[model samples]
Target chain A: MYKLIWHMAWNALGRRRGRSLLVTLMIGASLWGLLFMEGIYDGMTEQMIDNTVKSDSGNLSLFAQGYRLDPSLDRLLPDSLLNQQILRTNPLIKSRSIRFSHTGLLATAHAARQVQIQGVPLEEEIVHAGLSDKLAQGRLHFGSDGNGAILGHGLAGKLRVSIGQKIILSAQDRQQNINSLVLKVNGIIRSGNQPIDDKILYMDIEQCREFLGVSQGFSQLSLILHNPDNTALLQEQLLRELDDSAIEILRWDQLYPALLQGRQVMKTFNLICNLLVFCVAGLGVWGVMTVSVLERLREFGIMIAVGTSFQQIRAQVLLESTLLGLGGFILGAGSGVATLLWFVEHGLNLEVFQEGLQAFGMDTIIYAIIRPDYFTTALIAILLACTASVILPLRRLKQARPVTILNSQ
Target chain B: MDAFIEIAHLHKTFETSREVSTPALIDVSLTIPHGDFAVISGPSGSGKTTLLNLLGALDSPSKGTISLGQTMISKLKEAELSPIRRDRIGFVFQTHNLIPVLSARQNICYVMRLQGRSQQEQESRVAELAGKLDIEQLLDKHPDQLSGGQQQRVAVARAVASRPQLLLADEPTASLDSTNAERLLDLLEQLNHDEGVTVLISSHDSLVINRARHSIVLRDGRVVADHYERNDIP
Candidate 1:
């Protein structure tokens, strides 16, 4: 019986090909738009987060509890076997390094600016800091003695220095005395970040330690994760292992509240956009289905009069709507994937509108990402819309008097 | 056996609007034995179609008990009426009302399919009915493509394909010309006498009234006459 009804439903759709085609096209276009929108938006946000993590925060960070509020020499964490052991034992931690950042002044022949000097071990930073990848000039190496510095793009602009230029960096020593050094620029990094590019500098961690006259202390332990999703678990485990009252652990969300809030806003905005698209598609399907049902009023009456249960008729209608939605869903998903692949391969260049995108902290070139779940979500949304559309038509079916329907011309 | 289909004290009324009750059927009782070819003749507003609707389980009586086979259907819900109709009763309407989407063959076989008959049973029965109704050549043609007479032939084939205990047709010949009307009435008679399918058809045409083996004349929602007729071949 159910099979017969299903067959009938399919035939009904085929018989009304024009209406069904119109409905399918409406839903398919909406779904395709939604898929593209979701992919692009998610890709944009994902790229931003990934660049932020890669260019700066290593997914997780350890700091002396009060150190971020006050970046002072005295708050430096001691470099010990405990730190080394924790890094060594946890397989989830991809890489760990010590960083000693201090505020200083950089002066050159043409310019002068206050700079935040970042100290990294050359070999470790090469693999982990992605420092090597960001090089816009010269080499990433600071040499063994740390007498060289890599300038951020904006800092280089401000100091009027590039690779091979000489600059003077001066800061207070650990003992509260002013000390200075003359260094040549080793590399220039373009990390696409405003603050980091404008006022930050990178040098060898050992050299920064020597310049500060601190042999056993470092500012914070930075960690890169194999899978960033494991950051919270690792942070919890690391916190328990360390048991230090002076130290705290942080995840990317906690470390970057503003970015997290931005991602949330984008998500909600995408949801609203998708809902609007769904509403349009839903109204199309509903409008078509209502007309289709009305046009077949007499046929439905004959069916009911010939002993077709209302339940069976309702199922048949639901099946028809579902198949309609499935058609659109499949078409939408197929084209969505194709478009995403094209975007992923060639990238969508918005360089013409670069300033506008940059204002929102987005890269000029947008690469689309395909997440399978988005297709699932689109399918579910369409199915729900299609099913919900039939409630009124089904009610009409129930109230249909066989006599009246049959008697009508 | 208790009448193949029995109705007792059946009543139906419609509320046209507030404070007005118009009776359609009143104190109607009927017994139709198996293989009976019953024709109901009445003028418009005389309730022939209403009685057919009640007997087919398409509508319920306001106050009555209707037994088809063993199930009492008049008091049963629509859900219960469905299978009794699908398995034991078939309907033909004033307009052939063949499912427009289906071809003549599929439309004829639809009731059997609803009863979950096997594919082979459906094919054999559809083929048998097509041949009997002389619609074999029109099997693949949809209702709109078929002539009115062809559509009614398919409708009758559908009605008898399930071999139900009773077939209720309301104005089965209303849409037909005289020649086609005779063709359909002849088929209905063959279904009654040759196939032994009990048939109750509602019509007002004197030609139909003259052809019925048993004639039921209704007036103002009551049965005024019931008897066998010496069917005149005119």
Candidate 2:
């Protein structure tokens, strides 16, 4: 029975080919635009969050409780705390980078800038964060003497310095006395993190400790987890089990709430966009179905009079709309997936807006993220829209009496 | 003769607007006996169509009763009336009203399919009706592809394919030429005699009125004549 009804509906749609094709294309084009926007925007957000996590804040960061508020040389995380068994032996800790961070004036022959000088072990930094991959110029090595510095590109551009140039870094020591050291610019890195790229200067940790007259203590221990999803669970476990009350463990989201908020806002915006597009597509379908029903009143009347129940007619109408919607959905989803796949492979290079993109801490090239849920959500939404669109038309059909239609002729 | 359809003082009014009403049928009482080839003949606006509509269960009379077989159908709700219409009565409209999308074969088999007949049954019925109605060659064509006469024959085949007890046709010949009109009447008479199906039609065509086994004439929404030309069943 359903097969016969479907055949009838299919033939009816074919009778008005132009109108049917027009509605299908309208829905297809709208869905394509929606899918493209959602994929690219999500890609951009995730990339920004990824950059921050890799370059500066790992999945979790441990700091002296008062150090973030004060950042003084006196508030360093003690050596004993840094040497704890869990910090070194816990399976959840994939890698850890010990860093001494201090505020300093970085001076070149032509210019100077105030920067956050970070002292890190170059080998561990590479293993922990793939730091070598972010190098924009020069080599990742800091020379054999360990007196070499890796400058953030923004800071380099500001200081007008280049690889192999000399720079002076000055900061207060633990003794409250100002000290200075000279370092060679060995490399430059661009991590796509605006704050870090604009203000960071990296050097050898031992040299930095000697320059600041600090020994056996570090400011922060950034720990990357084997599974990032375990960050919260590990943090909770640590908070409950650790004997030390002076150390604080913070997740990436807590340390950078803005990125998380940006991700959430984009999600809401995509949802609204999906709603708006599907609603308009649904209206287009309703218009076509309503017109089709009105034009066929006599035919429907004759069917009703001859024993075709209203329920059957209603099913036929619903099937017609669903076929139209599904046609559009297949077209849109096929093209959408193809386009996203291409972009994922080649990346959407917007080098024309590099400066503007950089200002938002984004890369010029954005690769789209293709998720399974996008297609499923669209399928469900289109089905619902198709179903909802037929309500009024079905009502109109039900109210049109067979007698009136036959008599009118 | 046993009455297949019994009508008692049927009345139908159309409310044109809030301030006015028009009477289409008034105090119409008639009986159509089983296996009777009947015609309701009248001038335009004489309620022939309205009376047929009431008998077919397409519309309810404003004030009166209609009994088809043993059921009082005038008071039945729309949903309840559907089964009676489907299994007990069939309607052929003035226009062919063949579902424009389906081929003549599919259209003829429509009601049978709705009745949940087996595929073999539907196919055999279609073959039998196509041969009888001379629509065998046109079965593969859609309604738009067939002529007015051919379309009407297909419509007739569709109406009776479900083996309804009563068949009602409203102005079935009004749109056809004389030759097509004669052929349609011949098929109607043949079905009525061979299948014992009580056929009722509303028309002013002289050829149709003259051929009826029984005729009812209406004027000004009231019946003026109820005459039976041949009362003996074959």
Question: Using lDDT as the measure, which candidate wins?
Answer: 2
- Shares of reference contacts reproduced by the candidates, in order, are 0.71, 0.78
The C-alpha lDDT values of all candidates are 0.82, 0.88
Report the number of clashing residue pairs per model. Answer: 0, 0
What's the lDDT of the predicted structure labeled candidate 2? 0.88
Query: What global local distance difference test value does model 1 have?
Result: 0.82
Displacement of residue A248 (Cα, Å) in model 1 is 3.3
Q: How many backbone clashes does candidate 2 have?
A: 0
For candidate 1, write residues B119-197 as lDDT tens digits. 9999999887777677889999999998877787788888888988788888888777888788788878887877678
For the predicted complex of model 2, DockQ is 0.77
Runs in model 2 with CA error above 4 Å? A407-409, B177-179
DockQ of each: 0.67, 0.77
> For residues B160-231, could you state the per-residue lDDT of candidate 2 as single tens digits?
899888999989887778887888888888888888999999999999998988989999899999998876
Q: What is the C-alpha RMSD of each candidate to the true structure, in Å?
A: 3.1, 1.7
TM-score of each: 0.91, 0.97
Docking class of 1: medium
How closely does chain A match the true chain A in each prediction, as TM-score? Answer: 0.91, 0.96
